[model samples]
Target: MNIRKRYLVLILFVAIALGAVGTYVGLAFFADGTSPSGNLASSDRDLLTELADQQETIEENMGKLSKVVDAFSIIQENYVEEVEDKQLIEGAIQGMLQSLDDPYSVYMDQETMEQFNEQIESSFEGIGAEVSMTEGNVTIVAPIKDSPAEKAGLKPNDQILSVDGESVEGLDLYEAVNKIRGEKGSQVVLEIRRPGVDDLLEVELTRDAIPLETVYVDTREENGKLIGIIELTSFSENTASDFENGLADLEEQGIDGLVIDVRGNPGGLLPSVQEILSNFVPEDTPYLQIEDPSGKKTRYFSDISSAKEYPIVTLINEGSASASEILAASLNEALDYDIVGETSFGKGTVQQTVSMGDGSTIKITRMRWLTPEGNSVHEVGVEPTIEQKMPEYYYTNPVQVEEPLTFNESDDKIENVQIMLEGLGYDPGRTDGYFNKETQAAVEAFQQDQELNVTGEVDEKTAEVLQTTIIEKIRNNEDDYQLEKAIDTLTE
Candidate 1:
């Protein structure tokens, strides 16, 4: 093979082996600096002989790929606009990944790859939201707890339409994410199309360093029983260890039951989730099953022989995804624990990042992860044993008011205001996008409670205060019905 052909063959081998072993172990044969034509070690020679035997198949594939090479040459030699070779190569890789139609698989350039590594290893400066491409739109999976995204009112399934007033219509998931992330204290504006809303919402956020402290431990006393609550925000590098330590401390406190809450968690490393699952899932049954592209399945089990002495319950929501879903599924199916809350964000595929030996990488979905019952929750989310929906205002959109909503004016923003008012203990009387006298009374009541002018109208300032108050209440867990159900499940 010529130099270009040899380079392509090496890349193909690397991609194939990376999918199988998740490492570049096949590159060891080439590390000896032996040329293909030069005398080499016996094992290397045997490998080359084997390649020679399959040269026909290799050439056949290469021949089909010649069209792409020809297109690249044509574009470089005679395109209307000048394009760099690096750009073209990266674009080609991205195009291939896009063709797979899998939103989870994506191409990451060197800079993007570095940022990704930082996110997994330590921390990164961003708005702190996990996003995925859904139906050709960059959609928010969930906002990290206490991150700018969450503080800015970004919610799950919110579709990002633009960044800084520039449309993100053609940008990929990472490209849009890069635009949304910046240095700490830098501001980024996102135009969002939220579900069940008539107008697009513009959310401005100041980026900050998002730490990877995933595990949070607390105790909730229910019916005279101290129920330990372990909330995993994400399954980062040290999450398993942190969870173990937190659980140990909770056990030391002599808790009666445990609530594993992954309500708003996005997800992180698979190994992290696997390690955490090993603590609760017994070894008698498989905790997870991974099926490769060829339909081959590999079952993974925990080392534990028995369940925890305390009754355990899991909490999930639409924001719980990937690794979070894995943990909830294993706990529910393998251990027969009760899962409370809404259905989870269904993401059943496992993505593996394969470096291209040039700092760049491709995050490809290499396998499908199944629950212990061998059920896949790809688009269909995990069903809770006891479904507990939050209050209506919990799903309310932000009330963006350019024009004041007075009595007799009906709009979606008015509906949001009504929901917030009702959630804040004000009697809005109606929540069906109607701004009547009752809604005006509720607005005036809210305004008076906040010591603002009792205008009986939903103005910009009133709307802002309403949203802030509602957000504070939600964050403070003033009405966490799902958590209450989880605690009750254990206490009962």
Candidate 2:
């Protein structure tokens, strides 16, 4: 069962007898950072005060609350643009949260609150991607598997510079998400700037219905032995059950090795991940370390054990985050499971959501996440045992092609150019996995169609345009070198 959500609602006040006013303050955010050890010498602290002195303090706080109420009333009555009382109250709450300067601590208005709940319910529609403020830049955490985002070639760690031609350079994560999402069948254009890339890449994509499919699995044979691949899109409600079912299915297939791919999986519910890990990890042992406000470290243990001794390998990349990092770190730290691919997204902070009535909520960062081995995965993500960098055009490193691919060029990069050209409706006649005359002709046609110089070659400008156009509709093909490497690692 889910934990009951807590709230910090403001109680209504009444003008009391003899003009006395009342106000109360909760101490959840107030902290002095005092040590929690028993050696502290503040046992003789004053515990009692005069009634008049207490009354004075209460009145002082009351005056502050009164000013807020007065401001709310003024805004509701005198603002040129009509504003509702509810809007004013929500605005006040939003203003307070903004003052904290913590990107994770946010005020969810009624609409945002409803969307947030629906998302947790694991049913919603849009590009189907998770985003966050990474180092003050609005970055893609991960794109859900088989969703419009994945179809659009949106990769993790891609910083969104603009949405639909509007600059979102300093926009908050929620605002950026709102700008990116739209009605089904609508189109959105994203100007993205990725790490280790020299230029900007603009991806034009269509919004589609995001189905509630999180865990994806398939089995294949390599060297006459079966290898099971479990691809986790996100840590949603359906993940654990789907994962268990996947394991059962793979077991029936007589798999020799297991490869858990969290390449682009953004994390989900903590409890959900904990439940999933319980199957493979040992019980009564620390699988994760969480540090509270006072710097006290608490270890979270697994609940159950697996009957089968399965060798597991986890595949991660820059997009693997939160719950993804947890699964990777726990398996490696305790079970010694090797992680392949690139480093994961370093989001180590834990957010706690408190609901305010009328469908409003506030999510605040409460604690820091650490691995069971006492390693911090926040900002400095979990480094893979085998770091595998992807191709430059794989969206991880979107560098321009310095050399041009002309006729008779039989290089590997030319093969990709041929594939991309074929994907963009310019048939290259025969895709012999080389840049033949047909490939050069197709490049010329594409350049002519885009009003370029029609150079019949793939230069820096042509490569950038080709990569951007490739995001229109991505194929879940063998182009994922990192994934192929993980599969190969497990099979070998």
Candidate 3:
């Protein structure tokens, strides 16, 4: 549900509270003050009249509630099909709230309400992932690493066709997620279809507790100069402390340059972002500003009290959003840092989750954030300072364009091999129209690691398993391709 619905709900709650209070006070006034034994003046009579008016107002409001209850009773009794589940009613209310056309506004049911609260604490179970519905299909937005979904091989952009034999056609995103997720050790059957596949592939995966870890770090040497690479997946609850430790590790390693990879991150905690930015930015520097619908603006400043001097390069892509954008825009505009890669996923608004009495919570867009330079990045994404294309060889091969090879060994298998190789540092050439030697080498390496026959040939069984793995990785958005690209660019 949107901001409008949230405020509307709030208003309704307040009105109901006031009505109850007024009814109580009015009854007391009539019983105690307007007694026949009491000598009442004109002013007392006026006060009694005012109390009577409040009583009438309370009765009118109760009458409206009665009418609604009566209408609901009529529908429930006379409707063609029997409405058995109370959950359906809750879902309908949630759906109606969402129909207000606001992405942030939502009504959460009992299960989802608990999930939302847990999300704030930055931990949960059953397939760690963020999912969204696009074009009538449930697409994996991002999967938490080492989570059930990630371990089970979910990927970004993988369309969920069915969950446990139930067709998920009209089911919204949350509904689809609830269907896939369950208690640990429980198996969820998923029917998924890739981009260019004939039959729907069924993957039965056991659900597990998915812990949320936000900070990821590694050390790399760029032309004899060691560089510390910190890939912050998202700014969840413990992310600020996590990032601080990562920076301390870098300091211990004595790296000269730093690379912060924010690619494919959908963003998380706001203060966590500010905390991380303070590490690179100077003290009290204007970071990013926010403006609410009421035109009230709040400016957040960097608080890097004391830190080492190092050249920083923040890498971003189309998937970088919210808090990531805040940091990037702050550094890019205020500190004049170089940002690399494609345009960012422009989402400037801030959302605050509001809890309902029923245990469910609603996340509504409360405010819009702006860059330090006062740029509004709402649908218009942030463009990088240095525009770099994933080298032609990185994106695809020129030769494969004209003459594409037909794979008797499924296209899925070849692509899988290609991705593995790309991660291992040998360019798989192009992900384009063919399976070539580059792809074969990737296959060999993966096979060798698996202790399978090092034949490098994609047979039927290999193809099937390969499809499953690739589809899962893609579903998780944990592609080695993105990491490889970031590392390559840093080295270059």
Candidate 4:
């Protein structure tokens, strides 16, 4: 009985010991329904494997990404410091523009871009001149005639020292313009130093509506012949229309010769220049052409029908550029018209404005203009036919004419000056030289032709003679004036 009890006790003790060990193992590593030493229940292993797979997928997708930006955005949203979104956007835009290598390609905000466009369109008000920054200071390029900037005693080659008491240091042309331009009637104080002037002159210009002088015309006899002088200031939107009207006016006044002045004219529109060239060139004559990157060529032609057939002379200067060069080149090539004055500003590249999805636009140089002879005038200026230097008198007071006898303000007498100049054997170059240098030269030649004094100066007797001969030509509808004068002189 004692031996049997001892065996049962030992069996109960071993069962208790095994149960205790299993419970301890379960609590230590498999309490959440798994096994110790890498052994696990099937359901538990499947659930854990799914979780592991999901975690691995998430890490694979996002581990490569730098979350610094996202973190920064989050911080910015909840940041204590107030930051303007527009400022940051503008800064980003500036940074982007700075990346572009072109200095002209700049990022102008809505306000600045709008202001720039308006300023270009009006091209008036403000200082009544064109300005650009050079050498870190504002520089005056050209002053328009009768403008406040011109009348208020501002001149070209003047270095602007300061604007409104602010030193224009480290500023670009755009920045200088922003400081100089203001509302009409507002004053913009500009300290300028002219070439001849020693001390810096403080020019307090009372900003006014600068009247844009597109075309200026004058009719007076030169060297005894009635001639008309026209100076085109700029090639604006309405410049072509204005030029047409000027031509008509000169024609009505019996304009014998035409002098086209294009001095200090920074070119504007392309179509306007084409329209201007049409007045002299015959129809279908190529006015200008441009070649694109894809080997495509676009050509513009003359369309005007009532252009006069007379000696035409064109005057140009260093400021003449773009459309001016186009017009001058077309006339000189097509008509062999005489060109007087200095070389033109060489800028033949055409810019095409393309707008981005954002309200910004990019004016890119799309093509370069080619002359009729396939010559590039991008850096090389057009060579003049006559290459006449502008006389001091012409540069000073271009409208003054020597002829006392004015032409009849009628179409019949419109060609009178041409006949008179041609009668004098002056060859003002083209009969189109309404009152330009060619006509003046012809008048001087007429004085010389008549065996009188040849001073290139017109006297009253010379004017009377030229006027009478031209009137006779108009009445008789004679094409040759100089021939008749020679015959009459020989008879006399």
Off by over 4 Å in 2: 1-88, 169-171, 196-199, 305-308, 396-474
Q: Give the Cα lDDT of each candidate.
A: 0.85, 0.73, 0.65, 0.59
lDDT for each residue of candidate 4 in 93-177, tens digit (9 for 90 to 100): 4555555544344555555667667644665457677764444556675666666676554544578888989988766556677
Residues 1-492, candidate 3, lDDT per residue (tens digit)? 345334434454455555445444443332222324333335877968966876677656654555444445556668898875354446556666667666555666668777666755756667666666555688765556567665555555567899889999987667777888888888888887644455566666788876667788888776787888888777787888989998898889898777788866777767678777777766666677778668877666655674347667788776677788887788888777778877887778776655444566556566788887677887677888876544322221111112222333346435545654564454666665367776667666666766667776655455445545544445454544544555555556
Ranking by TM-score: 1, 2, 3, 4
Q: TM-score winner between 1 and 2, please give it.
A: 1
Q: List the candidates ranked by lDDT, beginning with the highest.
A: 1, 2, 3, 4
Worst lDDT run of 10 residues, candidate 4, spans 391-400
TM-score of 3: 0.69
Best candidate according to lDDT: 1
In candidate 4, which residue ranges exceed 4 Å CA deviation? Answer: 1-85, 88-104, 120-124, 133-138, 152-161, 192-202, 293-297, 304-307, 355-361, 383-492
The TM-score, computed over Cα atoms with residue i paired to residue i, of candidate 2 is: 0.73
Return the lDDT, model 3, position 26. 41
